[model samples]
Target chain A: MIDNLLFLAAPITVSIILAGILSYLGNHILTRGIIFVDIAVAQIAALGTMIGLLLGFAEESANVKMISYIFTIAVISIFALTKFKKQVISQEAIIGIIYCLALGTAMLLAERIPGGSNFISKTITGNLLWVTWKSVLSCLIMFILIGIIHVIFRRHFIKISDSKNGLPYSLWKTRAYELLFYITFSMVIVKAVPIGGVFFVFTLLIAPAAAATLFTDSWKKRLIWSWIIGITGAIAGMYLSFTMNISNAPAIVTLLGLIVFLFAFIKLATKRIVSHNLSKEKGS
Target chain B: MTGLEFMFAPLVASLLLIFITVYFGIHVIEREIIFIDIALAQIAALGSAVSLVIKNISGEAAGHDHDSRTLLAYLFCVGAAFLFTILKNKKIRIPLEAVIGIAYAVATTSAVIILDKGAGSDVHIHDMLTGSILWVTWPQIIRLSVVVVLTGGFHYIFRERFRKVTLSYHGVDTGLKNPKLWDFIFYMTFGIVIVEAVNIGGILTIFAFLIIPSSISALFAKRWTTRILIGFLVGGISTLLGLYLSWNMDIPCSPAIILFLGAGLLVAVGLRAINKLFSHQRQSR
Candidate 1:
C-alpha cells in the first residue's frame, strides 16, 4: 500500500503544478475567447508527434518537437485568417473544423502504422499516471520560464484575449505579439500533451479559470482563485481516481467540471435572490 | 458490388447532406455558432453511450440496434441544444465559445467514463467521431432524403422568418435572441440532421460538409439561391473527386473528401484573389 502511495505521489504533484500553470493560461484563454484553442492545437500537435514517430524520430527527440512546433505554427496561421476570424463563424466552430481536419489527417497518416490509433487516444487522455520525475522536472522548468515571460510581459500578451474583436491585423501590431502568444500557447500544449493528454490539459487549462471568472473580475484575484481551484481540483481528482480505481485524468476532469458548474449555479442562484430581494424592498 | 454502386451510394448520401447543411450553415454562420453541430453531435454520442451502457448492464450483446441509439441520441442533442440556448443568456461570465468548449468537454468526458465503465473499446467512440463516409448504405440514403424533404419543405414555408432571424442586419448586429420556440425549431432541425449524418458520414465528413461548402459559397455569392447553388456545386464536386481519389489511392475515404473540400476552398480563395487583382488592375488602368 505504501509502495502505491510512493508511486503515485510524483504524478499527483506533477498534476497540481501543471494545473496551476494551465489555470494561468486558462485565464488568458477565457480572456482571448479562444477556449478551444488548446484542444485544437493539442490535436494538431499530436498529429505532428505521430508523423514524427512515423518518420522515425524518437518520441523524445528534438526532431519530433520541431515537427510538432512547425505544424502548430501552420495551424495557428490557418486559424488566424480573416475569413475564419469573421463573426459569422463562432470561434469554436472554426476550431471544430480545424479539429476535424487535424483528426482526419492524423487518422489517414496513422492508418498503416501499428497501434497508430491508440496513439491518438493517448494524445487526448494522456498517460498522466505514468509521468516520470524527469518529465515532471522538465515541465517545471518550462512552466517557470513561461510564467516568468508572462509576468514580465503581462501587458502585451494579456491584451490579446481582452481585445475581444478584430482580425489579426486589427487585433495587434507587428503580428509578432500574437505570433508569440500562439507559439507560447502551442509550446505549452506540445509540452503538456504527452504527460497530461489533450482533455486533461484542456480541463486544467479552462475549468479553474472559467470557474474563477464567475466569482470576480479582478485579474490578480481571478488568477489567485483560479490557481486555488485548479490545485484543489487536481488533488481531489487524483484522490478520487486513486480510491475508485478509475483513470486519473478523467477523474480530474470530471471533478473540475463539477466545481465549475457548482460555481455557476451559485452565481446564478445568488443573482436571482438578490434581484428578488431588491424587488421586495422597492415594493415596501 | 460494382465500383459505380459504391460511388453512387455515398454521393447520394453526400447530396442529401448538402440539401440540409447549407441552409443550416447559413444560420449557424449568422448566429456565430460554428461548433453547434459538434456539440450536438458529441451530446448525441453521449446519449448513445448511455444507451450502450444500459444495454451492457442488461447483459445484451453489443449488436447494432439502430432505432434505440438514434432516439437516445436525439434526446441528448435536444437537451444539449436547450442548454446551449440557455447558456447564451447574458448573465454567463464565459464567452460563448468557451461555454461550447466546456459543454464539449463535459459531454465527451461523460461518454468516455460510461464507455470505460462498460469496458468497451474506444473504437466505437472513434468511429462516432470519424465515421465511415464511404460505406453509405441504401437505407441510410432513404432516411437522409426524407430529412431533406422535410427540412426543405419546412424551410420553404418559413423561409421569411428564418431569413429575418438569421440574415437581418439588426439581428446580426445584436446577437439574435434565441427565443424558446425559434431556438427549439433551430436545434430540433440541427439535431435531427446531425443524428442521421453521423450515422452515415461520421462526424468529420459531416462537419466538413456542413461548414466548408457554405463558407466557400458565402465568399462570393450575394443571393441566397446563388449561395445554395455554389454550396451544392462545391460539395458535389468535392465528394465526387474525393470518391475517385479514395478509390484510386486506397486512402481512408473521409479524409479524401475533407482534403478535396479543403483544396476546393483554396482554389475558390485563389480565384477570388485573382478576380480582385484583375479588378484592381482595371481600376488603376
Candidate 2:
C-alpha cells in the first residue's frame, strides 16, 4: 500500500503543479478575451495526434515524440495571434474557429487511417487509466520547467496582467512581458495536452481559475487558491474514478464542478450568516 | 432506393433548419446574447443525451430506428430550452455559463456511458456531434421549408414590434405592459430557433449560419437593411463553400462552415485596416 501510494506521488505532484499553472493562465486569458484558447490548443494537439496516427505512428512508432512538437507549434501560433493589436476578430472567435478546424481535420484524417477511428475516440475522451510511467515523468518535467519559468518571471507577468495600470512601466519592459506571457502559455498547452487530452485540459485550465477569482481579489491569493483547488480536485477525482471504474477525465471535471458549487454555496451561506449576526448585535 | 436515397430526408431537413437558425441567430447577435446561444446549445445536447438513454432503456437502437425516439429527443430539447429561457429571464444567482457547462458535461458523460453499454461498437457518438445532414430527404426538407416560411412570415408581420422590443430599453417595459403580445412573439421565435437548431446539431448550426456572419456584417454595415443583406450573403456563400469543402475533403460540414466564417471575418478586418492605413498616409502626404 505504501509502495502504491509512493508510485502515485509523481502524478499527484505534477497534477497539482499543472493545475496551478493552468488556473492562473486560464484566469488571465479569460480577462484578456482569449478564453477559448485553451480549447483550441487542445483540439489542435488532438489533430496532431490524428496526423500521427495517419502517418503510421501508432503506439510503437515515433508518433509519441511528435506530440511535443505539434503542441509547441500550435501554442506558438496562438501566442503570435494574441499578440497582434489590429486583430479583426476577437481572440475568442479566432480560437473557436481554430478549435473546429482542428477537430474537423482530425476527423478527416482519422477516416483515412486504418484503426484510426479508435485513436480519434480515445484522443477526444482520453483514458487516464492508461497513463504510463513515461507519461508521468514527462508531465513532471514539464511541470517543473513551467513552475520555474513562472517564478522567474512573476513580476513581469504581474505587470502584464495589470497592463492598464502599468502602462508607463510596460513602455520600458514591453517585450519582456509579452515574451514571458507567450512562453508560459506555450508551456501550459504543451503540458496540458497529453495528460488530460483536450476536454479535461480545457476545463482545468479555466474553471478552477474562474472559481478562485470569485473568492479573492488579489492575484497572489487567486493563484494560490486556484492551485490548491486544482490539485485537490485532480487527486480526489482520480481516486474516485479509480474506485468507481469510471473515466478519469470526466470524473475530474465533475470534481471541479462539485468544488465550484461548494465554494459558491459556502460564500452565499457565509454572507447570510454574517448579516444575521450583525443584525443581532445591533439589536443587543 | 439505396442508403443514399434514405439520406435525402436528413439532408433536406438540415438545410431548412440552417435557414431558420440563421434568421434567429441575427436576433441572438443583435441582443448580444452570444453566450446565451452557447448555453442553449449545451442544454439541447444534454436533453438529447438524456433522451438517448431513455431510448436505450426501452431496448431501442440509438439512431434512425424509431421516429418516436427522435421525436422524444426533440421534445426533450425544446423542454430544456424553455427551462433555460425561464431561468435566464428570472435572473437566477447562478452564473448561467457555469450551470450550462455542468449540465453539458453531465449529459455528455451519461450519453456516452449509456451508448457504450447498450450498442457496443456499431453506433458512433460522432453522429450526434456532426449531425446527419447527409441523410435528410426531400419530404423532410419540405417540412423544414414550411417551418422557415411560416416563421419568416410571422417575423415580417411583427417586424416593427420586434425591432422596438430589441432596439429599445423601453421595449422591456412595453413588454411588461402588454405581456401577452410580447410573450407570444418571444416564444414563437424561441421555439422555431430551438427546433431548427436541433435538426442541425444545435449550436453548430446557430454559430455558423447566424452569429458569425451577423457579427461580421454588423462590424461593417451601419444600416439594419445592409447588415441583414450582408449577413445573408456571407452566410449563404460560407455555407455553400463549407459544404463543398466538406464533401471534397471528407470533413465535417458544420465546423468547416464556421471556419470559413472566421476566415471571412479576418479578411474583412484586413481590408478595413488597409483602407485606414492608406487614408492616413494620403492625409499625411
Candidate 2, residues B152-224, lDDT tens digits: the string is 7888787667665555422355433454355445644565566555455535555556567766775687566
User: Scored by CA lDDT, what does every candidate get?
Assistant: 0.77, 0.59
Candidate 1 regions off by >4 Å? A1-4, A54-62, A77-94, A167-174, A280-284, B56-66, B117-124, B163-178, B221-224, B278-285
Best candidate, DockQ: 1
For candidate 2 chain B, which ten residues in a row score worst on lDDT?
B117-126
Error of 1 at A278 (Å): 3.6
Docking quality category of candidate 1 according to DockQ thresholds: medium
For residues A1-284, write the lDDT of model 1, one tens digit per residue: 89998999889979987887889989988886666788788789878888888898887699988988897888887675533344544555567667777887888887866778875676666667889998889889998888888888788776656755654345436266666667777788888887877778888888899988887888899999999999988998888888987778878887897777767777778888999999999999
Best by TM-score: 1
Relative to the unseen true structure, what is the C-alpha lDDT of residue A109 in candidate 2, on a scale of 0 to 100? Answer: 66
Estimated TM-score per prediction? 0.89, 0.75
